[model samples]
Target: MDRVPILKIGDILLVSIQIDMEDQVALQLQEDLAERIVATGCHGVVIDISALDIVDSFVGRTLATIASISRVLDAETVVVGMRPAVAITLVELGLSLPGIRTALNVELGMELLARARDEGVNEDGDAEDEPGTPAVPAP
Candidate 1:
């Protein structure tokens, strides 16, 4: 089985999927990513799927699961490089891919992740403020 390479860029992990996603490969990726997030303590995850022309329901679900896992680990996930046909196929397959944010390309995806990190919010919507720090400023 071919394992997807997960590279670390500053505080973010970049996953560029260049191979066909089989069931085992997808599951392995999920496991590997979770471990990497914990090991690296990265605050963001950018998954570039531009090379993939098709995304099946299982792959969609796997992506969602990966995002959820990343959120739980205090990292944000952004999927990038989705073709129009793939989007339509996902919709037709009835997979909305909840909890997955997308960007047009790797650069945009990294920007989105960086913005989310700057906002101090994880993918789970939790604020990453210091202890006793107010979420909003006083009048």
Candidate 2:
């Protein structure tokens, strides 16, 4: 079984899927990602799928599940590097992946994560305050 490696960069977890993922692999990835987020105290997750040429319903749901799980852990999830064909196929297949944040590439994904973290908001729109950080007063 091939396991997806999750890299911790500062406060972000980066996952680059470079192969065609089977259902079991995707499930394993979901589990591994959640564990990594909790273990590393990461504030964001960026999944790069640029190399994946196809995404079926199972894969799509797995991605969504990962995103949702990350959010519940107070970590933002940004799925980047979605190919144009994959996007169209997902839409056509009725897999819109609601509540999952996306970016064109890793650079933009990192920026989004940084902005969200700086604003004290998680991917699920919940407000979070970093310890020892001064809270901003509401205008």
Candidate 3:
């Protein structure tokens, strides 16, 4: 029944997962995140998983589902702070997380999200120009 907190920073939603997540908790998070994205009209989501040492296949799929849902809602999702062993395990398990974006840490994740937003692009680097808002020209 533990619920992860979702904080808003500018146009991004920050979720720092500090505990070992249960399956139900992960599902709840996905639901809550979708709700938050709709309620806040946020442009991005940064999930900090630095504290999680193990990410099983279920958890990996849940994360991917969350990212896909966020993208459909017009919010990009960035997962950060994966342990090295977890990365290797995920690859070995054939869970490459094809559509989920990632970063080494929260700072870098935030920067990535910000740059994507400023450039009017989605996490996939696709142009998502908002009406009446000019896209920042690439340098």
Local distance difference test, each candidate: 0.89, 0.89, 0.88
Give me the overall lDDT of model 3: 0.88
TM-score of 2: 0.83
Clashing pairs in 2: none
* TM-score, cand. 3: 0.82
Stronger candidate by TM-score (1 vs 3):
1
Sorting all predicted structures by TM-score, with the top scorer first, yields 1, 2, 3
TM-scores of all candidate predictions against the true structure: 0.83, 0.83, 0.82
Model 3: how far residue 60 lies from native, Å: 0.6
Candidate 3 local lDDT, 1-139, one digit each (tens): 6999999998899999987778888888999999999999998999988888888887888889999999999998999999999899889988888899999998999999888877764433443454555777999
Positional deviation of residue 2's Cα in model 2 after best superposition, in angstroms = 0.7
Q: Which stretches of candidate 3 lie over 4 Å from their true place?
A: 121-139
Worst 10 residues of 1 by lDDT: 121-130
How many pairs of residues collide in model 2? 0
Tell me the spans in candidate 2 whose CA falls farther than 4 Å from its real position.
121-139
